[model samples]
Target: MGLSAFQMVYWKACHLPVEMKHKALWALKFLNFDPHETQTKRRNQLLELEEMQLHAYDSSRSYKEKVKLYHDRKLVKIVFNLRQQVLLFNSRLKLFPRKLKSKWLGPFGIKRVFPNGAVELENPNDDGQQQSWVVNGERLKHYLGGEVERFSKVMMLVDP
Candidate 1:
């Protein structure tokens, strides 16, 4: 039993963070994938997915296929949204919302500012964000502390 299709999905699902787990947990609802199948079967399903012509994959029986087909077709624009949301859970900045506010509120004076500090706002692209960008504040470096290589207490943005 190398790996059942559902098992493979289960394995991946196990590694998935909360959002993806939610998506994978009830995967059968939105997508036609079985999170508890064998790998060989899953691989076969992926082959069938190749025939769906990307856009039409939603009509397929496996959500896994839709994801794979979308990847195969380079239809990043369509599949990225949900996948990106799932990926966000795995980001290091999971503490912050999709958007954030930054300030030199730390005790440090000012050394140098990171690229993100310069933009008004930039998307962290937590996951599959195709157009990830960041929003930064101007003159943020002026408030940095000299000994501070990094500061965790900077102003952060949160989703309402």
Candidate 2:
């Protein structure tokens, strides 16, 4: 069984230091956490962030928002021996929608990039075959959400 949203809220309230627990509770509510199930979402998001764009939006309006929300009284700090890195972006999470939870997924096990302009990825699944792909630098940029010129220029420098 997974941790109920209510149980998570209670746990936060019960164990966290007095002032900060409230903040932690707020974050939990915002994220719709179901403790055990919650792990998978963060795990996937971390995987996605590794090579994709990530933005952590602030609650306030601005030309740019990064880590902008401030809930001074309640901040929860728990550390994980995480295998993946997390990036955060704020988007609509409702449909009954919910706010886009703040977190990015990855560092998706990148094994190598070859001098000859091949981008290699460790098998993304349990497929068990190391993937060595040969492609143009232009495609690499697209796969990585960057400009073709950017990858091409870097490719030149890395070669010689």
lDDT of each: 0.40, 0.39
- TM-score of each prediction: 0.14, 0.18
lDDT of 1 by residue, 61-104 (tens): 58787788888897332221111121111123545544543322
Angstrom error at residue 20, model 2:
1.5
Please provide, for model 2 over 81-138, each residue's C-alpha lDDT reduced to its tens digit, 9 standing for 90 to 100: 2122211111222223435432222223334555654444332334555433333322
Which 10-residue span in candidate 1 carries the lowest summed lDDT? 80-89
TM-score of 1: 0.14
TM-score of candidate 2 against the unseen true structure: 0.18
lDDT winner: 1
- Which 10 consecutive residues of model 2 have the lowest summed lDDT? 84-93
Could you tally the backbone clashes for each prediction? 33, 17
